[model samples]
Target: MRVEMEFLGSGTSSGIPTIGCDCRVCHSANPRNKRLRSSILFRVGEGEDERRLLVDVTPDVRMQALRANLSSVHGVLITHTHADHCHGLDDLRGLYWGGGRERLQLFAYPESLAQLRRAFGYLFDEDYDYKGIARFDTHVFEHEPFVVAGVAVTPIPVVHGNMRVAGFRVGDCAYITDTNEVPDTSIAKLKGVRLLILDALRRAPHPTHLSLGKALHIAQQVGVERVFFTHINHDLEHDQINAELPAWARLGHDMLRVAIEADGRISTDEGGGGVAPLAF
Candidate 1:
């Protein structure tokens, strides 16, 4: 079995350029630099069957999915109920409900489920016909192991100020976003992970996000063989920041992909032709 992950988006709350500020990285013509909020797609495959899982649905969800060429989404595991994490959920209607109307499955915490229901009652209201008209069923988490698409997922708990959010550990890869700190219990669950996708907003401290230094510290604590930092901001340029990280730690880019094998080992698929780096 091989599990693959694609970085759907890797920008902060407002994304790059801030909608008005003319920062160099934001204004740069590099398409890779053009980010669209934070999100990712996790896929597990065996032989010819592939199961796809999505994490977060920022306001840019529709465009992001289209750019990634992902036609169908199997499930969504929300990290938190923040607007940036759940706003684009309505777009799922296009995929979830088609000519026949099929509902999507959403896995989230109890509080997050409540917020989603309240904010988008039209999706829940049987009478209301959404512009696209999609339906979704919610599953509550208990910070324990659960199964999605036949893959076992262990929910790693992290604190966002006073609120608790779900960070998932699937196979040997853990994807955690919007987290400043992971408690001991969660840290225990993340041990020996081959690849860790962590929050590294910037170099400075933040109230609810892990700075570069803090993210590195947490990665060290988790002792993952290869750690990739996501949920970044324009402040951390991709090219310059890679030189600052350890050999096994790098800043994740907008389209970076990682593969985790059945034994929980991690690597990247370079389109089957490039030479892989040798360990020193």
Candidate 2:
């Protein structure tokens, strides 16, 4: 099977070129240095039969969708309901308004869903006066792989400080963001994944997100040859970090498209470098 993953937003909560910051990465002219909040999109199949699953609904979702020319969002897979991750819940109403779906399909852990409901009460609340097509059919998933648009997505549970969140495995690629610890049980599920898009927040150790060294260690434990680190902070410069990494790894920037095959082959095209959609 072939799957394409697009990095809609690859930066941390505050994003790169953070406000009031005078860092070198912030001042850099390279497009790769620029980033939005963290989120990604998965694509499978083609034409009318195509399936798209969005992971996370970052605050930057509107801009991200416009940049990717996102056509349809068949489903949404949320890791957790942190402010940065789920703040775009309001922005996604437009998808339902414009698309053909009667109700948007969304999947997340039970607690994550609860948090989202509390945060965006009107979306799930039945008493609201606004009777719009922007409602959702929320599906709660646990450890098992759930089907989204004919694709089986396995939830890989990991710990972020004191809270539990999920990373997902779809086909040969696994996308995990906002994580610091992947327990042995969770790490076992990632053994055969050809491509891993993971969290590498900064150079220094963090309580919730993985540091550069720690993320690399986790990658080694999983034994994935090609890895794209996401949820980056301004501390690491794009080019300098890539130079320091092993050839199989690179710091993913906003709009990076990665293609992975079932047999472990991987190819990538930087968005600013060129147009990189295989099936779109």
- lDDT to native, each model: 0.80, 0.86
> What TM-score would you give candidate 1 relative to the actual structure?
0.91
Task: Report RMSD for candidate 2.
Answer: 3.2
Lowest lDDT block of 10, candidate 1: 271-280
Q: Could you say which candidate leads in TM-score?
A: 2
Top candidate when judged by lDDT against the true structure: 2
lDDT against true structure, model 1: 0.80
Residue lDDT tens for model 1, 1-280: 7887788878888876568777887776555556678888998885457878899989978877766767676788999888888899888766575324556778999889999999988888877754566877778888678888687888888998789888988778889999888898888889878788899999999999999999999998988888888888888877678878888888776667887877666777423321212111
In candidate 2, position 110 carries an lDDT of 96
In TM-score terms, candidate 2 sits at: 0.94
Q: Which stretches of candidate 2 lie over 4 Å from their true place?
A: 131-133, 261-264, 271-280
Task: State the lDDT of candidate 2 residue by residue for 1-280, as single tens digits.
Answer: 6688989989999988789889898877777878889899998765677788999999988788887888568899999988889999988877776566468899999999999888889989877888553689999999889998798999999999889988999887899999889999999999988789999999999999999999988988899878999999999999999999998889998888897754546878853542323211
| C-alpha TM-score for every candidate | 0.91, 0.94
* Lowest lDDT 10-residue stretch of candidate 2: 271-280
